[model samples]
Target: MRLTIPLLAAALGLCAAPAFAADGKQLYLDNCAACHQPTGKGIDGAFPALAASKVVQGDPKEPIIRVLKGRGGMPAFSTELTDLEIAKVLTYARVTWGNKGKPVQPTQVTALRVGAKGPTVKPALAH
Candidate 1:
């Protein structure tokens, strides 16, 4: 049987709360581990390694924007995950795998969400 967050949490005697209340590690395992792997080494060229990744370890906004924008094969989590969940997952990614970075907060995610813009279309030039 595949071990999921709730199952792992129950095994460890952790509470089975909603994703909003779940910890960063759990969120990461549930949502990102498939691609990024538990070791954060990722799947070579398919999925970039999160360990020591410049985007993951650099400014918080970088990861946040990527998560929200859906770069390459990475799906956009802006609609799927709550601000809190995104913050926790980003924080978890930043701090784990020997990476050193500041923790992201929901407020920061919210600010970015508010300021984020959809794709823009350029006006057609006269033919």
Candidate 2:
């Protein structure tokens, strides 16, 4: 019975992205876990860890650009993920595993998209 659900989803092409668009962990699982691991502890010497990394918790643009443009061995997700998805995934990483970073909004991701065309993203208000 449980198996049938997965099989049905697979057969109907209902097992990806859209179904989990707002879920950062799922998005990470689908797009990043292979290299970054489920716990955000990436394989040493291969992929960097997100658990307590300064980069992940630092300027959001650095990671945003990396996700969009890819760096070193990482693959670019700009073509596959929407701005909101990227923001969710990044926000998940930033807030998870004890790291202290600001939430990344979809507008931030949209702002950094290469050749992206749309309304300009306004700066966040000071708290």
Candidate 3:
């Protein structure tokens, strides 16, 4: 009957909820694993290891800023990831690889995004 159909739809919706939830680890792997490595230990002399990194362990704002504005060689993610995605990925990194930092929230990311400047694009020197 109508009640049975509604109940079934509710059950199906609950089952599909996990699928809609963001997977932070997967996001990190897709975006950061290449440089940070699966284990979070970076390549010596090249990329700095993220495991127990000061930046990761420090205030969430540090990593948020870094992600939005690329450092020496790392690419900025401001254009690539939504605020929620950045928050999730930062939260994942903070909790993993022996790091004990607090989880980052989307609201925090949004605040940082509002105040953060975009990555600097250095102009080429005139010949």
Identify the superior model by TM-score, candidate 1 or candidate 3.
3
Candidate 1: residue pairs that collide: none
- Global local distance difference test of model 2: 0.76
Q: What are the Cα lDDT values of the candidates?
A: 0.76, 0.76, 0.77
Candidate 3, TM-score vs. the true structure?
Answer: 0.74
> What pairs collide in candidate 3?
none
Model 1: per-residue Cα lDDT over 7-49, one tens digit each? 8857653232223234788889998999999999999889999
Question: What is the per-residue lDDT of model 2 for residues 40-101, given as tens digits with 9 covering 90 to 100?
Answer: 89999999999999999999989998888788899777777778788878987887778787
* Off by more than 4 A, model 2: 1-22, 114-127
Off by over 4 Å in 1: 1-22, 118-127
Candidate 2 residue pairs that clash: none
Which RMSD values do the candidates have, in order? 12.7, 12.4, 9.9
